[model samples]
Target: MPQSNTPVRDRLEEILARLDARRDRERAYVKLYTESARAEADAADRRRQGGATLGPLDGKVVSIKDLFDVAGEPTLAGSIIRRNAPPATKDALVVKRLRDAGAVILGKTHMTEFAFTAVGLNPHYPVPGNATDENLIPGGSSSGAGVSAVEDTCDIAIGSDTGGSIRIPAALNGIVGFKPTASRIPLDGAFPLSPSLDSVGPLARTVTDCMLADAVMAGDPMASVVARPIAGLRIGVPQGRLLNDLAPEIAKAFADSLDRLARAGARIIDCRIDDLMERLWGATRIGSIAGLEASRIHADWLSDDAALADERVKGPLRRRLAVPDEAVAALLETRRALAVEMDERLSPYDLLALPTTPIAAVPIASVETDANEYDRVEGLLLRNCQVANQFDLTAITLPMPGQTRPAGLMLMGRNGADRMVMEAALSLEALLRNS
Candidate 1:
């Protein structure tokens, strides 16, 4: 198993000390469970010292996204009006699973309001700076979870992905994030963004950490990821709109990574999926499936306290509130059709590979100050990875090799193939790291 070698108590203290530093406020933790976390760490350490049987996640420090229920506290889902919402009666399902596996729960991290935005700007809380560059935006809406994973605040960060929230931030922050098929991990205690599109997953510095948390959360019993051989692996590279408007750094790193894979004996095939994407996008023209679903989730709130939330979140969602019921029905039908088509389209290949984001993280000020920039960056950030959510596929994002600026190479597979994607990522991650 790939559990951390450091003592759990020491690791917890190190993270707590770092979080306590005033300058780290931009690191974006919304709340800290210091007392309970310390108790858990002590328990884990005692278990370790006693030569107890340990799960893969035993003694690992894990952070929860603010949207998950933690018992006795209302899940904010990055919204303000929920301050007085009734507290949850129990931990979220995934939270309970992680604890059962002996993970040390850290605390909840910040997020975009209602998990709506791609750029990690939460006007309601402290925004997390990019892990590598303070000036760059940490991708969202799993903003703080992403930061916690890369910044070593936690060994694993539990987050939700709807329309690329997990992969976008993982790519920008240069960590590994896995989005299992939406149904793989139960979502009962998570605050909904778009229930149809939402999947809870993990972000961490290594694919192993993500794989461990994923299995635990899904009630799977796997202890380690066996790296699949790169030789003869069929890797499909989708060509067209998903690859459009790439920043030079992203483009070069992607090209370089492909060269490495090809040289390592993987078969690289150029696949065309632009028409499929256009159809998917065309179907949701009234409002994105996420936007439409979110409209319904926030229906009551929009009628009463919409003005209290960030305009970026409430404005777009409010527009979707009036979408005719028929349009929503049609959209769901189209989503099912697209998922079937995508499943067939991906059948021939073991996996699909692409740059996770068209561009690297941009200056926080640029997106924060300009609505135009925010719109453009949000669309681009969500462009490639949203295909996975729309089609119900599984995916993982690993940092591209040898880049001064971080970029991610995302690998995606058909629905219900979460473990297949992880096995491939195990080998691919090794290949990328060596390069």
Candidate 2:
């Protein structure tokens, strides 16, 4: 919501200066599109001088997650194995849309290897540090995308969400992230983790920025989001295991957020969404959709040389290969049925609110050294966000107020209700800011 009268190129230079200053400590970008970005900024300035502008994001710096294609660059996707992969002949559809909107392409940000893990740990590349605490893990696979926005390297970060990649990093880094309904954004040219669940979205400082970026990426008309009256909004709080485990700080922060909403006239109702949760758990039981899809994509590469991948990823990849075909079929059927059930369940409420993650960001050292701890933390981090992905709902994570550790209050709406979700998020964000 902050506006600057400075020239686009000038502001970009200032951001570049800051990026250079912290280059040694932060690994937010795997590639820097300096020349192209400067050229784009100059063009934006020319457009402004001619009294013609692209839109709200014209001349804004935006970073892409490595999974998305950029012409002339190999999409490494945070993996050394893909270092020798062929360069993309053209930009991904979303990337092309960003360019068409007059956004300055900052560069491709780092991510988890093939976006396999929730905890952003890349043995091949320097792991991007947490925006809030360097000692903590930056939630990933879209690790650098979140850090790029938090660090002011870009105005917004374009990222993908399969199972909380965008929201987890946003929650951990204390930023805003939006995952629209899967069908809202085209996925052509993006490296897939799960064709069934992948959705392209943005991470930024405010819900407005995300709304603008989402519109641009989807090729939809830019529309203003008027915050709905909070007093009349019906918000459902799922009363189940989703709310069970919480770090003291996170639990307190979430409770206080709900209390603030209630005081502002929002009707907060405790509801049971057991059927929705059960379907999600069942669909993901045999092998993750992402893991299965990733296995198929990487079959030849893994077969040739397993040593190319990190040990942590190799184990999961192998397990995905062993899943029974019958199990996958059953899970897919359950997923289809549950998607409908979830929509019906959520139709009564404006939104469903939950803690973005059960715990705060874990120390990078803890997860890196202990595999068991990594598994436990990964599950906890992905649990709440993955529900939206499985049920095909649009979701957004808003940073919670008064938290010593970063925590996110997530708002989820019915599938294809992305605009509604964003408007509600704007209202909630305003309430939190005032409180």
Candidate 3:
């Protein structure tokens, strides 16, 4: 198929064109389930020419992470275990919404098996190119979603964020990723990884793209707010322990970003939230509730189809077996307490800033084969962002393109205050561009 001549499609169409080209070059898709997608896109084009339009995203091509159901396609989720799983009889809620809004479903993108890991290395399928660097890890479990967007194959790539699955890949691949309040988006028809932590969002080229995807996924109307200036905005930067553990390149880029934001008139404040490390450690020790829920959700498959599971995915899946009942209870209590704690802390500021990930993309080869290396990648990948998920807060990662290794300036807000966080993010995005 030739690229669209209509410039109105912008980011969405450009990506679909590139995706088509790359599929021929790198052989990325396992199913390439797009027979319906082409028909949908053509229908959208006819609507446009006939003076009918859905919204700003009308007629754009979108790629769903394989974990999501697309009516007739199987939800592979980059696993061999469900290779013979029956096709979905209906589209996932988010998928149906996109179709209603004029988005052409561009089939499913690949990911880590059952989305167990942060690095996007799937043994069951070929690894998609990381766009910036061919050899580096794409940052998973949303690996191909980010790949599809970064390579311009899809304007918006939907992904579920469970411990940084969406943001990690987006950060590594230089795209915008939003991890919204956990319960905001419906997880009705998607495959479960850690249900408690799995909030689906998108990886896109710009903040606008992320916002558009977020609206559709949350089933909210798309509304645009003018980018509020960052001048006099209270933005806190935590130091001491939380910011102490970072790679030199990441630290330098973070420091530079702060200086730039401050110069652009943001009220950059130095502060430390009490029990920062202790709270995070407690959350981990409590055995991620999502992990346990994932196990429960997939109990039948895990028991009957255990042998067919990917070896790399099994290690993380096993950890769920060890989540003590008492620990799960304790974690739930801590989540409530921590929410109160964070609310008190963030009450004084518009947003808290942090580096999305401490290091850039690691090599794909090492991350795929060695379990220890996989752990390292997971740790660094989810370190900063997962904190927001644990507390049920909202956060966004804004790309910092000038850095040697691509990094993101993260903005975090209190639970249920996603709108405020996104407003601050949009302001910060403008501040970053000017600076």
Say which candidate scores most in lDDT.
1
Per-residue CA lDDT of model 1 for 1-435, tens digit only, reads 224566788888888888888545555688889999999888888888888845978888999999999999898888888999999999999999999899989999889998988999988786789989978999999999988888888889999999999999999999999999999999999999998999999999998888989999999988456988888989999988888899988899999988998999999999988888899889888999999999998888787662699888788888999999888998999889888998998899999999999999989999888999899999899999999999899999999977776889999999998888998898889888888
Pairs of colliding residues, candidate 1: none
Give the runs in model 1 whose Cα sits over 4 Å from its true position.
1-5, 23-26
Ranking by lDDT: 1, 2, 3
Better of 2 and 3 by TM-score: 2
What would the per-residue lDDT of candidate 2 be over residues 272-371, giving only the tens digit for each residue?
A: 8986787667668778877877777777766555367887778778788788767777877788888898899888898999999999898999999898
Worst 10 residues of 1 by lDDT: 1-10
- Residues 1-435, candidate 3: write the lDDT tens digits: 224556334433555566566566653445554556667777777787888888766777788888888676678777777768899999899888888888877768888888887877777677876878878878888888888787767778898888888888888888788889989999988888876677888888778777877787788876675466778888888776668668888888788888888887889998787475477576766456666666666666655544677766565556676677677777767777777787787788888999998888877787766878878768777878787877678888888757765677788887777777777778777767777
Clashes of 1: 0
Q: Which of candidates 2 and 3 reaches a greater lDDT?
A: 2
The TM-score measured for candidate 3 stands at: 0.91
lDDT score at residue 362, model 3, on the 0-100 scale: 78
